[model samples]
Target chain A: MLLMIPGPVHLHERIQLAMAKPMIGHRTKDFSEILEYCTEMLKKLFGTKHDVFIISGSGTAGMEAAIACFSKVKRITCIDNGKFGDRLGKIAERYTEVDVVRFEWGKSIELDEVEKSLAEGSEALAFVHNETSTGILNPARELAKIAKKYDALVIMDGITSVGGDYVAMDEWGVDVAIVGSQKCIGAPPGLCAVAVNDRAWEFYNEKCPFYLDLKAYKKKLEDWQTPYTPAVSLFFALQEALKIIEEEGLENRIRRHRELSAFVRKWVEEAGLELFPELNEYSQYSNTVTAIKMPEGITDKELRGELKEKYGILISGGQEHLKGKIFRIGTMGNVTIRDVVTTLACIERILVKRGIIKPVLGEIEA
Target chain B: MLLMIPGPVHLHERIQLAMAKPMIGHRTKDFSEILEYCTEMLKKLFGTKHDVFIISGSGTAGMEAAIACFSKVKRITCIDNGKFGDRLGKIAERYTEVDVVRFEWGKSIELDEVEKSLAEGSEALAFVHNETSTGILNPARELAKIAKKYDALVIMDGITSVGGDYVAMDEWGVDVAIVGSQKCIGAPPGLCAVAVNDRAWEFYNEKCPFYLDLKAYKKKLEDWQTPYTPAVSLFFALQEALKIIEEEGLENRIRRHRELSAFVRKWVEEAGLELFPELNEYSQYSNTVTAIKMPEGITDKELRGELKEKYGILISGGQEHLKGKIFRIGTMGNVTIRDVVTTLACIERILVKRGIIKPVLGEIEA
Candidate 1:
């Protein structure tokens, strides 16, 4: 079976084997060595020389940690252009006063609006770098520059973007950035890596959840250990997955993601379908997933169900209000051109049979 | 190498192979079915027909969740007899005013002192059912009875005791109970199962950490899903481990744990070693792990180091202030009489070579 969802992506055999390794005590020297190696590899994947902490929960847990630990301001500005961006705002609201700049799903963020909100006593700016739900990559570099002008700390959710795309966290002045192992890192779900700039410590709040407290994580990392018992097997799998990333250089891996996503986008256009997200000068299409608008007559159940039952392929449909309107095809992690071609071929077969598009000469085999 | 530590005990080949299974999206029907099965199995293991929520973090995360979600009182009584018991108090202090009834590391709790503390307007009682650090099983039933007399909630940390012992949570009136995957269940670490009685919901606090919030878990369980993306691979391993427990029968599993712990206790007596924790009429020895006093003139480094280096056996030494005074051997989840006998033999050989014990005729082979 093929997994083409935004996250919990396909796992490599090496990672699966790593996960199967015998259990070991987390307090032992052997486990500490593995933690150290994984921490260093995660630093490289996050594009930061600053501290990176591995958490045992999902990407959403990392998102909560980033907000709860660092949001010590009177008010924070959150930009919500999609599902994940909205989640950032919701989590921030729980910690402090939040000013959420909301946008329609799949629509681009307005830079002026973000700046204006930050100007109104907002001491921090929280947003998602890549909105996986809508297949749009927000302008992280430009947003950081704007936040810097207002002297606001910048927190970015790089879960779907970090390993698969270019994320210059330190260069962009991102105070805190988060990534999920199941996404572009190609490990199983349950681990989250959070990178923090040294300056971000100034905003640390003691009221953060005890288990997700950043201060505890930083202190424990001195000995290459997690504050609490980590999911040891997940760490093993993550280390192997990061090693795979190291083998194929980060730049090369990013190129692969870009190429595969581009292939999917081209196929959508050739097959007479429209891209889901609307982009501006700063906003761009996500390099890890491609979202296409569903045709007028095809229902989500019919299309996705047929794909899963008949072709053994799994992809995600639109979430929340966009349900049945857009379907997404993920191209992150260990995805190859062959996988993308097969998915596109299956989609073409379904559409042609539904009378949504006419079969082109030689295109069916291609 | 054998894992004789309290947690992260020896895992079976079935559980390891289960961890190696391919990834699946958490939102899919296939994954939901797996979640439903694991939840039902966990309910039985917890000995509660109430709601059980799975969190994708360590047991400590579940500990914090139990305290942060339910401690909505003027003051809560926390029992501190060992490392984990102390942790319960510390986490509770973060949520509410805490009255900690402290005891020595290897001493048992006094029932009268607990009643007096609860009498002073403490609306809840938080304690560890099994103090893994000192290898003592606290009197969970008696403590719950005391809390019920004062109309207080009962929160128990059953991390190392739930699967290996008879934890009648419903009968004992335990409002909230927690278990870890790395303990007697013999699954890999990183997942925590929390069972919440229906009445406990009345004490729910909105200030709980977003990632570990019990309310969110309860709401999501209606759809047979976790509020956040779970550690997918760990869930697979846990399901397999729980299946093994089902096949073995819970009563038989508890009996095995009890018999193995008794065997260790008998060996300790014959070797002229003392049990670590001083027990009372209500308190008892743990069925999962055995704590033994270090012999005179034998340092922890010498005894444990020799076991690891020469025998490839892993055991735990005392923690914190008791660092060199005691050593613990675990007999939980898939551990057999042969494994215990082999460990005992290795310890006997080390003691004889160090002149700490005399080699008796026919006893060495036994």
Candidate 2:
């Protein structure tokens, strides 16, 4: 079965075999070598000169680490334009006082509002670079620039954007950025890589949660080790996945993601469907996933369920309040042009069967 | 190569193959069914009626969760007799005020001292059930009983002991217990199973680290899901490992661990080697691993290095100040008599080559 969700995406056979390799002692030289290689590759994927620590939890764990370790200010400003952005705010609230700038699920955040909030004693700004839930890519570079003017540390959740899109973390002055293994890196779930700028260490919270403490990770990386026992097999898989990323070249991979997502958007328009996120000058469509409004006359169940049961394809439906109103097609991590075409074909077939739209000539074949 | 260290032990072929399985969406019904199965099997392995939440991390993360979530008190008494025990105290100190009762490594803690410490306004007691570092099993039942007398909560780290030994969490009044996938469960490292008694919920700290929060785990378990995206491939491997445990029968598995450890002890005596831990009536040697003092004519390098270079076997040496003073053999998770015999033969050959001991008749064959 093909996995077209935002994460836990389709796995390559090489990665699967890597995951099956025998376990080694986490403290051994062999494991350390693997850790070092993965760390180096992750630094490339994150576009950072700083150290990127591999955490043995999901992406949200990395988000929590980013906030709990660096949110040492009197108040932090968080942008909540979608589910993941809202999560950043929630996690930050647990660490310090938070001022959450809220927006509708598929709407872009106002830059003036973010700047105003940061002006009010907020020492940090946290936001999601690509909001997977709403399929919107927030203006990370612009936000980081705004935060820099206010002398506020910028924390970005690059989970769905880092490997698949252009995320120049160091160039954009992102103090802390996070990515998930199951997304563009295309390994598996359970590992989160966090990149921290050297300057961000000044805001480190000594009382941060022990398991997710970035300081411990940094100190241990000096010896090519994790502070705690890592999921050794997952590391093996991640190394292989990173090798695949390196082989493809970051620029080429980003081009593929952009091309596929643009293709999906074009298909939605041709098939009489609307894009979910309301795009503005600053906000753009996510390169990794496309959220489309459910076409008229076809229920979400009829559209998604038929795709899964009949075509062995899995796509994601809208989450939270947007449930049943939208559908998402993820084209991240090892996704090819053929896979996208097949998915579009299946969606078109389902819509045709439901009498939602007339079949377009040559579009299904394309 | 054989893995005879405390964890990341020898993995069965089934478990490795299971890890190679394709990824699945964490929110899907199929994944939830797998989660439900693993949770039930983990409950049985932990010998508890309470819920067991699976965290996608190493065993140390589980230890941190146990302490951070439940150490909400004026002072939590932590036991520090070995490396793992000291870690429990260190993690507890970050969340709450801690009174660590220190003891010499491999030495039994004084029960009277523990009682006195608990009597001094401590509201909880945290300790390791199996001190894998020194190959000793602390008196978990007795400690829980003592903590109960003071009406304090009991938290136990059963990382290396839960599946290989008899750990009756509910019966022993253990408020919270943790186990690792790599140890007695016979899976790869990466997943940690935590069992929480219903009564332990009252002490839950809302400020606990967001990623490792027990309350979030409990709430998500109601829907047969994890709070965050789990390590999907690791969960597949763990489920397969749990199946192997169920087939072996918990009582028989514990019996095998006990018998193998006893065999190791007898071999130590026959080889004129001393046990590492100073055992007492209240303290016993660990069933999952055996620690032996370095003999007279053999350096740790000569013994362990030869075991690894000449013979394809891996064992653990001492940590911290005890480094080079002792070596440990782990017999947890699918360890067989033949494996033990082969390891013993290798050790005997190294000792004889180094002029440390005379070869015994029929012992090498056994």
Candidate 3:
């Protein structure tokens, strides 16, 4: 069976085997140095010239840390376009007093709207780079530019963006960048990958809460240790995943993911179904999982169940209000164009046999 | 090499193989449900009728969570008699004002000392059962009973005690019980096991901090989920470890550990090395590790290093203030009397080689 959700994306057997090994001591001299070197490699992956720290929590945990580190303002504007975008808002609610701006679902943040919110609140701003809920990858670099224009610190939820493409943290004005192991990192869940710009660390240095304080972690990290006991096995697998990514060459890996995404979009278009998000603003990182609206007379639950139960393919149904209205598929992690095409072909069969859509061969699956 | 320095006690081949399994999607139905089951089993392992939550942190992280949760008061009194006791004091200082009730390094805590302190202050009392740092297991049940009398909730660190000894949660009247996977649980590090009683959860139900909030996690545990991504591989390995424990039967397991402790203590006395701590008031849970003061001129470091480097037996050299004074030989986990006899033979040889005592060995390594 092929799994084509945003994350946890498909994994290679080598990575899985590594995860299954007997766990080791996190305090041992052997694992400590492995941790030290991996952080350096992660810094390179984020394209940032700074320290990268790993937290033993999920992507949302990283989101919580970002808001905790940048907590000078009571009113922070969140540009939420999808499910994950709303999650960013949810995490911020724990720290910041209010969310100033929230965008519509399946829509990218309007630059004018962002600028207007920042001008009014003059506080911090956060949004997701690739909103997995609607497959709308925000133009963070351009958005960050607008944020910088208003002198608001910018942070991004790069959970699905990292490893699949170049975030170019330095090149973009992103102050805090967050990634997770389950996404493009090609590892299991339970680890949070965080890279904060020098500016954000400066912000954290000045005003931050206790638990999410990265500065406290940085001092401990110098010794290649977390202030807390880390998920040592995930650290082991993550180290291996990075090595594989490094051997694959970052550029080539990103290009392959983009190729897979494009292939899935072409097949979806050919199936005569309307793509939910604007085509021009689609995410290149996760292709197969787009917010696909149910065509007339077809419910998202019926289509997903048919494809999953009839064929051994696992795809994600839309989240929250989008449930029974939209379904999501993805070409992330170890996914290839072949897998994407095969999944589409399965969906096509279920749709036609159930009188939802006429049978059509996907480009690669056929 | 025999790894007998308390925990990471020793690894079986099957567990190591389990750790090496390829990574899985933690968010997937397969992985989420697997972890969900692991959480349920962990509660049973703790023998608690209340909520049992797993934190993807260290034994210290478990302690920190306890501190963070039941931190309703500013003054926390830590019962100190050894290295781990001081560590609790050190950790409490970071988040709260602390008071320390002292006992000597090689002595079990006197219940009178703790009772007297609890009567003076309106603060929670913290203590460790089976202090790995000193080979002295304090009478946690007695201490919890006294704390209950004073209306002070007890936070007990049971990292080394849980799997090896019979520590009844509800019967002992302990407010919060803490354990870890790496210790007597006979698994690896990267996870901590916690069981919060009604008394502890009462404090947790309020607007506690986020990362360390036991209440926030309690809600998630209702569905067998963590607030953040957990170390999935560790969770898998722990599930298997608990099954192994169940097959062994808890009473028989504890009995074996107690017998092993007596065997080593008897053998050490026969070898003419003085045993540290109160003989009657000791740790039966971790019977393998025995900490002894160095003979007249022999340093603890020389004894431990020679054993590891030459004999291929790894024992713990002392930590902090006890360094170069006491060396620890642990016999917990899957080690047996043969291991103890072999290790004893080596110790006798080393003592003779260093001219501390005459060589005497009636037992064979096999």
Each candidate's chain B TM-score? 0.98, 0.98, 0.92
lDDT of 1 by residue, B1-366 (tens): 888888788889999999899888889887898889989988888899999999999999999989999977889999999999999998887889999999998899999999999998899999999999999999999999999999999999999998999999999999999999999988888999899998898898887888888899889989998888889999899989999999999999999999989988888887778999999998999999999999997799999999989999999999899899999999988898888887888888899998887654236333
TM-score of each: 0.98, 0.98, 0.89
Chain A alone, TM-score per model? 0.98, 0.98, 0.93
Preferred candidate (TM-score higher): 2 or 3: 2
The better candidate by lDDT, 1 or 3, is 1
lDDT of each: 0.91, 0.90, 0.73
Shift in Å, residue A143, candidate 2: 0.4
lDDT digits (tens) for residues A66-143 of candidate 2 = 999997788999999999998998898788999999999999978999999998889999999999999999999999
Q: In model 1, what lDDT does residue A73 have?
A: 88
Residue-level lDDT of model 3, residues A155-222, one tens digit each, is 88888888876688888878888888878877777687778877775455233334446777888887
* Tens-digit lDDT track of model 1 for A305-348: 99989998999999899999999999999888888888877888
Q: Measured with DockQ on alpha carbons, how good is candidate 2? A: 0.86
